[model samples]
Target chain A: MLDTYKKYFRFLVKYRGMFVLFVLMLTVLGVINAINPYFYKLFVEALPEKNYQTILNILILYVGVNLLETGIDVIVYLLGDAVILRAARDVRERVFKKIQDLDFAYHMTNSSGSLISVLKRGDLAYFGMFHELNGLYRILVHLILMLVMFGAINGQIAWLMGASFVISAIASKYLLAYNLTTRKAFNKQEDNVSAVIVDNLINYETVKYFGKEVKEQRRLSKAFVLWIKTLWGFANSFRLIDIVIGLISAAGLWVVLHRTFTLYMSDVIQFSDFILILGFVTSF
Target chain B: MLDTYKKYFRFLVKYRGMFVLFVLMLTVLGVINAINPYFYKLFVEALPEKNYQTILNILILYVGVNLLETGIDVIVYLLGDAVILRAARDVRERVFKKIQDLDFAYHMTNSSGSLISVLKRGDLAYFGMFHELNGLYRILVHLILMLVMFGAINGQIAWLMGASFVISAIASKYLLAYNLTTRKAFNKQEDNVSAVIVDNLINYETVKYFGKEVKEQRRLSKAFVLWIKTLWGFANSFRLIDIVIGLISAAGLWVVLHRTFTLYMSDVIQFSDFILILGFVTSF
Candidate 1:
């Protein structure tokens, strides 16, 4: 993995400034998000004081902060697009140039259909990797920050939240692994379906001469049957992941909120604290 | 659009039972979601009564309701996949067969690369259309249900939410139209990029005979340049939509919450009502 990243790093190094700025913006966004629940705590706590203008001021500031977050998000996306797309373009061009540099014998040995599929899938995979990595980074930052916030208020609740996170992360890991396996199978079938169609199209002359149009059509139909089956398998894996994650989140929310509500009832914490914790968990 | 859906309705009619069940589940889900904020109201309102048992019961029921929602979501996804994928398979097979039935002269006139692109994109477009339409349906259901709940509490707030929805919808219509235009341009450039590569691959022998590998490489390089430009244009359009929609949502949220909070301060509404409305808007 390190070796693979090292290779990708070369492409990104050219856009180092923009990439750095993008990461900075993402980190800023994550921090802003982690701190957001505190604002609700502030708002709710202010209400009991019955100072309308002060409350309104807090509300305005809160909205302003949210607006700022949106602005940062826009900037992050623009920077990400500028950096990732350019680097990907460079990588693609390099790959294209290298392919052309291959000897005649290599070209004769390989089917161009599969080659095109590999290249297309590779380009998309690059973008996917970058996008998912950024998502993971943001989630990590938010989770850690939230855990710290939770710990500051109540250690037991923090531990509960932490345990749930660990469990959910582990569950996601295994579930996503399973999902990836199904996805690979689906992708292979999809490629096969396209390859069949493309080959038929490319070999139109051969099919016409042999009068094998019906044969090719039957072949594509068979491919579609498998395609449909694998597609469902892939889709079903997503449902499985959602069900598992949803269950975990619900269980976590129930436990944490129950504890927080009990604390509030007993005067162990204020109502705003309860609301803050609720905001944090639900937003998660 | 009605005629287009009429054609799709034929495919869906085969799984009419599942389709009905899916729609019913969606409605139930939407109703459950709209009422969810009221649970927070109940929880908060019950606090002063010092009714631990009652509160716990409400909490349990709340979690149970959420679990039920998750269950329905899973069923909806499964049913949707079963129905849509199967129907789409039939449509794809019919299109494939129809393409084969086209005369030899038609086949001779059209390039296979573009035809293959059409078939592939069309299959995806069918899936996309179904997926997006279902999403729009869910949003519509959820919005209307939410508005009804809001109206029951305060007509002015309902009007506020309704107006925000209208404005957002109109903005989305225009913004998405812009997005679609950019997307089409991107798709055209993407197809051009791939067509160049596929054509070169398919005519490898011709290129090899002419020793035009360098020229082919340069052609692909030029195509990537345009592809990058159009892809950025497409990506930027999404940012534009997010900024506009985010601004509208924040403004609407600020106004509604400000009104609700002022009412709570003046004792025109209970603390629970404020919390409930806050839950509704934030959840949106």
Candidate 2:
């Protein structure tokens, strides 16, 4: 997997300066995503104080920031498209060329159907990796910015948020990994159903000659029974993940809200700030 | 498509009580999602006035709502999973059985790989449809609840919110359709690349006998060149969609924020309500 990723990254970097700009745009978007909520906090404070000048200034700035952020998002999306598209193309081209360079004996033993599946999945995997892998950088920037902003509000709140984030992240990763394996099972069962359909179709002439269509139907239904069981397993596993994640998020909210209550009661935070903190955490 | 959906829905209804409860859970979750933000507004008002009883009650209810939402979400997810998994299983089994019943001659011409791809994608499509289709019901409930709440606070702001939602929904639909086509093109290009690789591998001996390894590389490279151009087209079209979407969402924000500012200036709403409205719209 590392070797494959290295190969993929090499293609990403082949275009030189474009990839850097793409990364930069993602970072900018992440910062905007993180800090934009603060404007609401400002507006919340300004409105209650009846600070007309401050309110007007903040409204205008807020709209401007939103529009600017939208503009930056377009640029970031474009850069991502360019780098990822180009990289995927390069990788597919290289893979195709390498296939052409392979030994004849290796080709003879391999099934074209599976190879086609590999090729198709590989391109999609490239697309998925480019977004998810590169977005990691953006997520990190957003997270750090959020942590700092939370810390500035109150240390305890920051700790709660950070701990929640960490626990949920870890919990979801495991849950998702389990989901992935179950999904893979679904995929395999799917492939088996496909193989059955394809094999039956390919042998149509023999079946017709033997007049065994009814027998074939019975055979297919047997596959269905197994497929149903597999589907149930897959779906059940997904529900389990959802349940676990939901409970984790709920627990986090309970803890966060409890702490916010204590802090507000003790006058450690202002009403507006309390509102701001709750908004931030809930939105997060 | 309608007929297929009808069949799936029939399967979903086969287990009577679960489906109704699932829909109820989704509706409840939607209302919860919409109303949860208003708690911050309540908190803001309660804190400054030092209404300890109201503050405590609201916090308790707020935490209660969040936990209840999490619980309902789990139930809804589980029911959805069960219904969808059963429905999909029924469909796949029926399809498999039908394949077996087909005239033997009908199967002779179809290749296994293409059939396998169809079966796999069909199963995934079923999974995607179940989640997205059900989620749509939840979204509608959420949107209606939000609009009603906004209208109660301010009509013009409500109109602005409603219009943005409609326009963005339409824009996204059109944009998403175009993206689908471009994605299909990418898939086709991917298939072409796969064919080249698979063909070269299968005919490895012929090339080896002819000592045309370099010639095969050239052939593959030629395919890659076309594939690269197709990929760029696909990527460019996707970026176009993103830009259009960005612009639409930005315009929506601008209109909504402008209306919000006017409402606040006129003192048509409370300061905390202003904070609430801004937070809700922006967070949305």
Candidate 3:
């Protein structure tokens, strides 16, 4: 997998311009998003004070910022989509070409499904390494910037948020790894089920003529039941991860809220600052 | 497409128990979500009085509800996954059996690649239709429930939300349809590029022995250029759609904000109600 990712990255560098544009657009969008909470804070503060002019300005700014961010997001998505589609197409074409050049003995020894699986995997790996990893990198960059901004506002609060994020990240990584394992198992089980189903359906006439439909159905059902059990296991595991993450997020919010209240009561934070913290925490 | 959907629906219905359970779970989830805002409204109303106990109770209730929903979601996902895996396995087995029993004349008329494509399309269609349509239906159902909840809370505001949702839905549908067409075109162009790549690579040794490397490179470059051009077109089209949809969503949010401010200024809505309204608008 690591080697596949490395190779895919090299392939994508051949069309660096498109990817650079994608990254640039994402950076712009991230900056805009990071700035949005401040605008909301300003707008909320202006609203209660009956500062009509300030309210109007803030509203316009909010809309303008959102529109700008949306435009950047659109461009970023398109660039990423183009890069991935092209990469997948190119890689798949190369795989087909490779297969065609392989010796006859290689062809005879390998199942067509296995070859197709290889091509599909190659295509998927390319997409993940280029499109997904790039997106992940962009998000990480933006997250760090946001954390810096939060730290500037209140270092203690930022520390709390950062800790929560780190914990969640670690938990998510473990969950994802587990999910990957289960997903692979589920996929294999599904493949078996498909093999069985297809066998029965295509040989329906043969089975019926042989008066073996009942026997075939029983065999298929047995495989299907096992598939169901595997699927249930996968879903239950994912559910636990999701629930834990949600609880962690809620706990983080509670801590932030308590800190906000404490700071406000101690006259260390203004209402506007509290609102800003709330907006940032909620949105992030 | 309608026929395809019908066929897929029939296939799903063949596993009626699982299908019904899936729908029921979604409906229950939708109903619960529809009612959740009211609880928030009640909780927020009690907050200003320094009602920590009620707030804590609400928090606990919120967590409990969320966990319950997650539990149901997992079960539904598991059930659906089981059904689909079984269906896929059945189909693939049937296809394999068919391939084994197929006459020589049939193989002669159809290239292995073409047959593979057919089997692939069938398998994908089976799984895609099952999973994608289920998701689409769930969204539609959730939207309806949201509408009902919004209408119950405030009819005029609900109408405004409905209008924005309609516009967004229309824009989304149009953009998706356009993207699908462009995607299909891009696929065809990529297929042609793949064909050319395969032809050249398979005869690479022949071309090298005949000192035709430069000619082959030129030919490959021609195909590559066409592929790139097609990619650019797809990118441009997708970008246009993304921009349009993003703008629509922004506009929708703007309308919601305006309605929220109007209700708040008129003193007809509490903060909790406002929060609920925000949730509904965002959900749309």
* DockQ for all candidate structures vs. native: 0.59, 0.51, 0.25
Docking class of 2: medium
- The local distance difference test score of each candidate is 0.82, 0.73, 0.65
By lDDT, rank the candidates, best first: 1, 2, 3
- Better model by lDDT, 1 or 3? 1
lDDT of candidate 2 over A193-238, digit per residue (tens): 5555555654667776788877877666776676777777777776
Tens digit of lDDT per residue, candidate 3, span B1-284? 57866766655667888878878887776666555545535544554454556656655675567557666766677777757766666665565555656555565554443344356557766877776777777777777777776677678777876787788788878787777777677666555554454344434456656866566555655767767777777777768876887788788777766776677667776555665665455334
**What is the CAPRI rating of model 1's predicted complex?**
medium
- Give the per-residue lDDT digits (tens) of candidate 2, residues B120-211: 56666787878888878877887788788888888888888889888878887877777778767766655555555655654667877898
lDDT of 3 by residue, A134-248 (tens): 6677667666876786687678888888888888899988888888788777666665654554444334457656776557656766776777677767766787786778778
| Off by more than 4 A, model 3 | A1-4, A33-40, A93-108, A138-142, A182-240, A243-284, B30-47, B91-107, B172-174, B187-237, B266-276, B282-284
Residue A184 Cα positional deviation in candidate 2, in Å, after optimal superposition: 4.5
* Stretches of candidate 2 exceeding 4 Å from the true structure: A1-11, A90-119, A134-137, A180-184, A201-220, B1-21, B89-121, B169-235
Candidate 1 residue B29 C-alpha distance from true site, Å: 2.8
Best by TM-score: 1
Question: How do the residues B9-99 of candidate 1 rate in per-residue lDDT, one tens digit apiece?
Answer: 7888999999999888877777776667677678667766867898788878878888888898898888889889988888877887787
Q: Please report, as a residue range, the 10-residue window in candidate 2 chain A with the lowest summed lDDT.
A: A110-119
Q: What is the interface RMSD of candidate 1, in Å?
A: 2.3
**Model 1, range A68-122, lDDT digits (tens) per residue?**
9889989999999999988988888788777767777998776665677667777
